[model samples]
Target: MTRTAPAPTRRPASTRGGPVRQGPGHRRAAWAAWGFLVPITAYLLAFYAYPMYRNLELSLRHYTVRSFVQGDAPFTGFANYLKVLTDATFVPALWHTVVFTVVSLAFQFTLGLGLALFFARHFPLSATLRALFLVPWLLPLIVSASTWAWMLNSDSGVINAALGAIGAGPVNWLTSPDWSLWSVTIANIWIGVPFNLVVLYSGLQAISPAVYEAAALDGATGWQRFRHVTLPLLRPVSAITLLLGLVYTLKVFDIIWIMTKGGPSGSSTTLSTWSYRLGFGNLVPAFGPGAAVGNILIAIALAFGLLYIRLQRRQDPS
Candidate 1:
């Protein structure tokens, strides 16, 4: 009886026209996705791409203040880039910017991490306190810089008053080339902390409670739990926040401009402020060099962005 039964034939994968059918639904879904993306694509092309193209064009053009008025411009090729790179002022500005970015990133990240940790715990009045703490970031950049400038004024400023009370002499914070950069950094830190805190706090919230519970059950203390569980989980967020902070700090202009305007001796000039000074503020208006400076900044930011993307890819290979 077993031998007599014929083997059942296998059916083909397809019914009519093909082995496997992929119909209009798949094609429609793909078209719909492209349709959804069209608006943002158009916006980027119109705004960012066009502006960047124009800036690159401007970078190669030789246009002085007089040239701007008379509509007479000529191609200068890489001369602008050469001038910017060779300038003595540009070298010091670059050094100051690098130093400021490193030091400010350290302070902002450390302080922000502490604040994030503090706020991670469910404490009374934490929300209100956080709201109050964000006042520095909420304030306009010019206003915040102005306020710091006023406070740091050598004569009769609050800082000087405090110094007098503490028996420390009034320090010429902005007037001295030595302290002017630090003064800008301090104000920048105040503005930057809130952003870091918010980012880190959100990261902290994403950590699952069950993991903490499991750690506690395994006889882990708070520090141990945080070190093994919390810190590991927060690494991605930390990297993103730190990189973003670095980029923003690198592009800092308003605070430096408002606080020091390149200072009593050009000590506080950053790339952004230096670019503005070279391009628009000077009587002759060095447009080529200014655009070159801008291009340099854009390169740096793009580098950081690329690094972040690479890191993210490494972290999530799937």
Candidate 2:
């Protein structure tokens, strides 16, 4: 037929170029996504963002009990930060924090890696032993710290009694200035190892057994395989583990406070305990300086977290 076909209908330019009309299903999906997102956004704002803002405000103000309640605290700019930097406690607290974090991380990672490797063999009672090893980690921090305090007691402690049986002198673990940091550090190491073990063990389990078989067939010894294959594969997990441990160890206050109170002369006081002592451990609290110290700790953790993220990006092939 020579009759001209009817011209094809076309979408309006606005519909094509400006905005597409979403169907009911698309609208519902978008609403569902918002529904899922809104609660988390609200929660984060209420809990995390608001608290951080308040802390920052606190650090920048000269707040006393009167002013705090009245909400008339005067802003002092960076005076609080300067005061914290110049305070005599700053240097020692920073040093102690470094030592505590380093020693705990080193020992925990080493022991955890060793244990993970051992348990990877799937020996008899492996599951039982692994579960038992989680006791320190699973216990409440207060309970664990209290138990350590009692065990490390200078007088009538089981540790000292055991030392006595071995003809060794009893040492002041929690009381002495010389041993306070070390005592808390040992307790922290014990508490942290199980976490490291669980994480690293899971990482090891994700590794394919075929890789190990290939290494064995290529005449790679156990040490060689671990160094070349296992370690490389576990790099991502190890980085995250160490980063988390670093942040946690930096802010640890419960174990130190419960065990040693950062004392005999503040020898064991890290930044966290020092901050608490400033804020609430006295008759007249230095809220401004205390908040300043807390901000410093937060900054340190944030810096390390950023570094870890950057390193991860560089390591990621995609």
Candidate 3:
């Protein structure tokens, strides 16, 4: 009656010799992952990293077309960078670049957000309309630039014709030094709107219907709801969008080149066009200084990229 079953004794780790139970399949999978990564790592090192290193080397050297032909370029340390900084076109081109980027981003974000909000509400043919709006983004940049150039031409252009009809007396859309930078800025904004629309619309779609419903129930107006609910949720997307816009807009050469050739007295020149002007625009190319300008652009991009990463870490912290 009193014979109760005794509990089983635990095995000691020393006697058990634990964790020796992994199979060959697990080892194969681990090896396969590294094997898969090897090609990607090698490709990145060969293509991106190596070229960047070579560019840095070129920037440090007193290289020219003759030196390239001779396969010898003597190192001049930071002289090329100094030359780029002191060059006549550098300051003005840099100023135009800043103004162009800022104005373009301001208009693009404002208009794109408006379009995104408009499309967020359910309506007839909304999806089809949204898809149609992506035409600007899908077209080649060179094509868009060429098209805008023709449209903005002062003579025999639709814009000038329309202005003349309205008694505005044919304002110079492209050739005037006062308006050349803004002309390209307008075209850039048009080209960039679709990208912002699609991205911001996706972000808006991710927001919960219940959240908006609750906000509406709490006596929030349309603007109030957008400010309190939508904006807060969309901050991350907007941050990345603007940062990428900065990087992309900063390097916009084709639009400025095709539209104005940085012309009408260097009014629309950006750093990218300026770099090209340095390296290949004329008979004697300044390869070293051009490379230096490109490297400076890369540095600015990398700084913003690092800032993006820091923001991501703050958002995650995991």
Candidate 4:
């Protein structure tokens, strides 16, 4: 029998030392990825990066209304920042910001955790009650602030009325310097609780039921199970929640502005309101100082964010 010549073997594309050709699908996927990236890139440039750049530039310049409009601002280096540091409002605003952030975060987290644990039992109407609790969060911030303003009115407010019914004297919620900071903090806590509840509740759900069962079988009480099992597992979620709440509280301006306009005499002024007051609340706005204050706020937030990331990396190493 005649032996047929062996059929020529085709080498694989990668083995042949030629450029490996990509399929149409690969090209399409690459194009789609680029398409997805382009809009977000443009948006960040337009909205975030550009604004930050402008704000930084503003902080470094002596820009009057004429110069601002004409784009002829004189470069002043750190003069604006120096002015802000030396300003009378700086210390008080910083202190108020700290108190507001810490107090609001404390109360909100505690109440939210309590509610989350309560609802995790999944009792009848728990979902309904949770939804109802979200009303403060669901209402527009302006509306909420306004309502608080009315309710806290010195003479004719509902809160004062309630206190009167209980035989307590009317306390100025929004008016008094001593109470103004607390008032805004309380309102902020009320608004923020639902967010915490939702997040913590979801975190609780992610804890396997078997973990709790195991703890129970080990003769752990309810408190012990929560202390050892629940709290440790919820650490990641709680950290993130607190961080977000801190950032949000640090920048809270609307509620304070609406209710107190940062004062009976600058008592409730946080950095955010102070920045706004410098930038726009006055007849002759201190644009440079305002921008400097904003930059300071940004730096604070960035520092905390970096710290959170560092702590997370230490915990997870991976």
Candidate 5:
């Protein structure tokens, strides 16, 4: 034991024969990271930031398209906002928007959730069927709206033809103010369902199979498993999709415009259509009011977006 050799002392890094060398790899990696970031930075600055600032500036100025073309406009403080807030047209339009958003969301979410759950179950041609269902979403908005408009036309349209064949009498699809919003909403629901389905299906796929197995082993049935596990797990994705759908549906202009142009008596006018009317409809263009409506929509959407970000943050604690 006494003769046992003492273990050789380990040399400190600084006491090594030569100083430790650092490769240029870290600096190169940093430069590579910035190089990759530059294009996105430039794109955001040029497209998103500048345009948003310009829109804000325009909202503050009393400028029409004519005035903009002539370059003879001045800032008008909060007069635009005041006019928008007080306008008789604006409030009803806002009400229509609210109703459309709520109604469409209700239908889309219910139908979408149902479709999502149905599609998540394994079946033949599931991928193909899912892709086919997305056709409405993939189609150009103008084209899809036009197609629906044609289908809903009072005379010789397919829907009216079908009604005639079925002895139900031809129903006014777009002409009536009462029916116009619902018709557009039907098209919107069709377009939006695929989006919700896709997102929810992906979220369902992300859930671990082990959990479902355990639930099944515990005698859980399909509905019970879905209620207890699927709904709760899909909450985050559902929240995001619902908020996005609300934001988009609130600003829907093309569907309404293409089908009815704010309708028989402006009954279907949403805030977006109202803004367009104010901007460029009649003898006197109300650019200020239009911009104000747009700004209001932006504010609402931003508020929702902030809420979404906060929820995502809470979910991701790390």
Candidate 6:
């Protein structure tokens, strides 16, 4: 019994080496990932991060065309920002920016949600109609602005023509100071609706039909179901949609520039347009002030983005 079995020998824990074998495959895979990321990292740094830093630097200094050319801009604390804040056009431009953003977002979201809901119904040609609606969003902003420019032109424009046909006086849409801002705002809304529709429609599709069935069983009517079930579920998607829409609308430049150039006594001048005016509009461009205004716009967009991030985390703690 004592000699029945010999004790098994225990193996050594390890040798002096940290890793017995370092795999070539794993090292190659890591290098491959770095290789793929390198170009994107370079592009972002070159195009976005570098430019933003340069612009911010320019904002804090007394920069000019000559200074820019010679690389010698004198540091001037917050004077440039002060100049922008005190400028007469600054207040009006800020107001126009606010009005344009608010009005365009309101109508865009409303019409887009309406279209999304309508298309959510599986009717004949629903998919086709939705695809066709994407034409506005796919077109270049220049082309869209040009088309609307012709449509909104004072004389011989389609819009005024329609008004004349309806016995209403032809309104100067782009030229009149009273209407220029609204005209651009309307054009922007038209351009933005298709994007919002696509996003919201996709969100709607992601929702389960079983939820609606449950709501119906609970005696919730159409509007009640939408408000209680659909809207609550759609909150996350809606937040992202509105957040992006706000940021894009705030930075709108091409439509305003192409259509009005913020014309007719600067009535339609938005913050973006005002920045352009300050920087390159004058013979002696005010680079510092222009950069300052641009930085302000960026700050606003950043604030909204941070808010969105905060909301997202709150909704999804994980």
Residue-level lDDT of model 5, residues 4-37, one tens digit each, is 1111112132443542335868677677878999
Q: Which ten residues in a row have the lowest lDDT in candidate 1?
A: 1-10
Residue 88's lDDT in candidate 3: 85
- What does the lDDT read for residue 173 in candidate 6? 94
Off by over 4 Å in 2: 1-24, 310-318
Overall lDDT per candidate, in order of appearance:
0.83, 0.88, 0.83, 0.87, 0.80, 0.87
- Candidate 6, residues 44-131: lDDT per residue as tens digits? 9999999999999989999878889998889998999999999999899999999999999999999999999999988999889999
Candidate 2: TM-score? 0.88
lDDT of 1 at 207: 83
lDDT of 4: 0.87
The C-alpha stretches of model 1 lying farther than 4 A from their native spots are 1-42, 69-72, 313-318
Better of 1 and 5 by lDDT: 1
Residue-wise lDDT of candidate 3 within 8-93, one digit each (tens)?
Answer: 11113235434433786877777787898999999999998998888898899998788878868998999999988988888988
TM-score of 4: 0.88
What's the distance in Å from true for residue 141, model 4?
0.4
Show the lowest summed lDDT stretch of 10 residues, model 5: 1-10
Candidate 4 lDDT tens digits, 139-249 = 888999999989989999999999999999999888899999999988899889998898888889878999999999999999999899999998877887787677667
Model 2: residue 232 alpha-carbon error in angstroms:
2.5
List TM-score per model, in order.
Answer: 0.84, 0.88, 0.88, 0.88, 0.83, 0.88
- So what's the TM-score on candidate 5? 0.83
- Residue pair clashes in candidate 5: none
Local lDDT at 301 for model 2: 83
